[model samples]
Target: MKHPSVRGCSAIVLAAVLTFGSGAVAQAASAPATTPATTANPLDFYITPASLPANNGDLVRTEPSVFYVDPLKTIRAQASVQRIMYRSVNSSGVPVAVTGTVMVPYAAWTGSGPRPLVSYAPGTQGQGDQCAPSRAMATGEEYEGIFIAGLLARGYSVAVTDYEGLGTAGSHTYMARESQAHAVLDATRAAQRLGNPQIVPGGPVALAGYSQGGGASAAAVELAPQYAPELNLKGAYAGAVPADLPAVGRNLDGGLYTGFLLYAVTGMGAAGGLDLSPHLNAAGRAKLAATDNECTLQSIASSGFLNTAQLTVSGQKLSSLLELPELKTVIAAQKIGNGRAPQVPVLLSHSVLDDVIPYDQGRQLAKRWCGAGSSVYFDVTAGATHIGGYAAAIPQAFIFLERRFSNRSAVSNCWLYG
Candidate 1:
């Protein structure tokens, strides 16, 4: 994911494409016990707190469906896909509706223990219901069609979360750390409880994501010990993780990538129910309203290089949003490093030339997690920008997760660097 430049175009849609092509998961808060028999419409529902069950991460329902994935030259015929509705907590710890896809490979476990699960989180797609992967895939237009195909080809069951409010009612809590983490972790539980032949309950599990997803995977690592301790999590591979949102906002303030910054503002505000009309001038208000229903690519194409200061009544840049008295705490709370170090071994990768998320922040995150005594294998790869890091890190992440699922321990790299 390059900064708000042309790279934002691809990065913005990364999550939407990855999840849609991989499988489908939809919000079913108002649906009956049984899901409708088709993947044609995943967003045909209304969500209310009264509509959600009391249990956190509980499986609300499941729609048995086919995965609209690319050609799998080898890996176990195509995997079976399902649209799932699950319960999860929001930033405020309230039980909220969440949705995502689950894919179970056809091949049985022939290697060793119970078949392992991979919780896949995609990068930023946008802040609209239309951006939901399940809805997009059902339409046969999911991007990154090949990314998830490769994962299924390796014989792993995958679960992808749409996060709170993305497919349901209310605003999407786009980068809220706790909410995203809960969605990722709960989606795994939903998959385990699924009444399917493919899922192996109490099996080893691994987490993987790039860019925004990478950050969520990292958040789940720290949160799982308390939030979802029952999960048999083995390890996580987070590449191009965005540990510092404030720094990102400042960096992209007046640049070509301000679209991401704009998305962040609207997303965070929507989650908090903050009427940003007070802060934005006519231009800012018009831009935000215009991009509300659009996905990342459209958002970028229309709102790039436009200065955030010009949109504000006070002529301040994106930093103005970061500093809003009501929003400051929320933004700070979204940072990832201060939390407990995830007990599982972590494989973290970042590109030296990453323009979207700073490389230093990734390194700083590794250092913090290491200080907290977590076993971390940090990689600083070269040449690739933020989005390109996915291709580079994924192949290596595959090996790292493979060893963990096989119950192998990683030699601690912290001792050498610390």
Candidate 2:
């Protein structure tokens, strides 16, 4: 699978414009509340059994309940539970409606005045709905629902966005900022409208995610000053964010992590209206098209997913599709931080041993925001892998959110040596 050629100067020019123009558009759109608009009815986008492939062996449209400790648990063992829904959407104004779960704690109605909301954007899991529910307990797996359940226990409402596509109709735009940001922010809005009284109105709110979620959280932070100003975005915590797309593409190509690269190229193509088939020959097109609907993990499971033997006219490897000069030009132009740092305080953490997303990107992002005069607290966890780093960083993340909601500067050295 050779890389596509930028043979025609016209194509090169057009790519340049789309890449840079969207960036400018994103930046220019980052201020003053635009009148909030209603997205299409979410029920109209449900993922029915008939919609899935017969051979697809993943769970779909299933509801699960989770048990948690409420604030009164110490007095008497009271079990708190939440019912969650996993469904799809249409008219997100993109190819997919985005699939995710909405959780309403049973204790929400128990005399607790509306609780503050926390919308979580999870890191790269897979495109399948089975793996990306908003609440960890919904999966019937013993992972970390503690953070989520603890928030609920403390009387805070939470909603999680699985990102656009994934369990729906389009490709998952793995780390694309705008799409990810829109899903997280919009889902919060949708959850609020879902009429769970526990979801506080005009309450202090926060955003948190690791890796891909970190990238989305960063974009949500940047987008909130204008996109959803009504929601009190007190703070954000991003861990091991793949802030620089080109840099990540370079490190992931042709390695075991290459599936992410394919997802990026295919996803961006779908989102940006680039026709990759024209660049690929018959065989290349087949490979690219085959992955259009696959999730991140599924794509990796399939073999020979890319034509790594050839090169684009720019002499880049076929696997470098995501790192094409034209793509890089577009990404750089977007200026994800939008030439300004997030208005709210930010906490960013990364591990030096993270092989998936290089730690340098995290450092650069912190430097960029801090240099732009944003209050950013950066932490580099020692001897932590990507997953371990997230756990190690969570306690501090809670502290950061707590301080922001309390209207005080976060204690700077809380996670300094962890």
Candidate 3:
């Protein structure tokens, strides 16, 4: 459906975002790593049941939990929290258990109708089981906890997915878009089934995320219609979405964020059951093995700026490896935008100078969505790096959700691109 195009975010918002751009970028580099205190034990909650649930999103288990806004675990959100394991399918269409957290604020819902739910897809937390957001949030170490708190403060219950394998028995399907989408949508389903009076089963829902989370949210939005048609999905906020893996991989080659590229390659390989060992030399194999239990901070600290050529037997960069016939098909299947256009309104934001996740690819996604006649509000910003772009989009993203939940009309800016 073609929604009317309206004016983009005003100049004041852009100026305010720019003011914090540099600081946000600096903060992104040193984002807190999950402390050892949280990972000492193998939590049984993440273990898949011997018998799987028959339906997707059916709750496997639930336990009372906590949420913290700081590393000290002092500042907690004024909400009820639960760590949950639910049924979700993986990329190969096999049923797998996914873990996540569902939080509902204690404050009364002052918004119109039932309180809205934000099915939040979290940005990368690393591939390790201990790096799961549910664990990090309990220890007050989750980097995205602040954003989840923001949603709670707005009286919007939040469901944050750990994605496949993050807290489970297998390797995390890092950039495998379909699996991420399944985890996200099922997280929402699991949240509603928790029987919270504040969050009605068919209540308003919005997908929100940045970076990996952005890609997951984007994928979930595209897949929601067929995967979970009963959801009352309102709109989605996907910022700095890695819509094209090849584009993103090429940009990250030999750069400061090469860790992300490595994560993608290793993750896709694990998810697709491809044996990358043959192509990798000793250094490459060791590097890939290193990520088996490491989180984002560890990966970046250890692997940043290291060229993939040094790790490959053929001395080809990681970007080149993605072009292999077997790998190319896997990566191509992960690409979003060429498939279904979202049925609801979408606020697709990107920074022109995003140091991570190239900008042009994001614009191309917007253009493609527009061509497919989706309701798209393409919000363009300037001078923000990857993290900065995320910081800048938070307020605007929340506002976009507010408008949608309030039943306010969202005008698309798709015409501007044409």
- Best of the candidates, TM-score: 3
CA-lDDT, candidates in order: 0.73, 0.58, 0.82
lDDT of 3 by residue, 206-301 (tens): 999989999999999999999999999999999899998998999998988888888888788977889888899998888887766677777677
TM-score of each: 0.87, 0.70, 0.90
Worst 10 residues of 1 by lDDT: 24-33
lDDT of 1 by residue, 25-88 (tens): 1111112233237534334432434677667868887776554532221212256678888888
What local lDDT does model 3 show for residue 321?
86
TM-score of 2: 0.70
lDDT of 2 by residue, 153-223 (tens): 44456777767665454556666677788778766765655554656557667888877888889888988
Looking at model 1, the pairs that clash are: 1-386, 1-387, 4-257, 25-100, 57-87
Clashes of each: 5, 4, 0
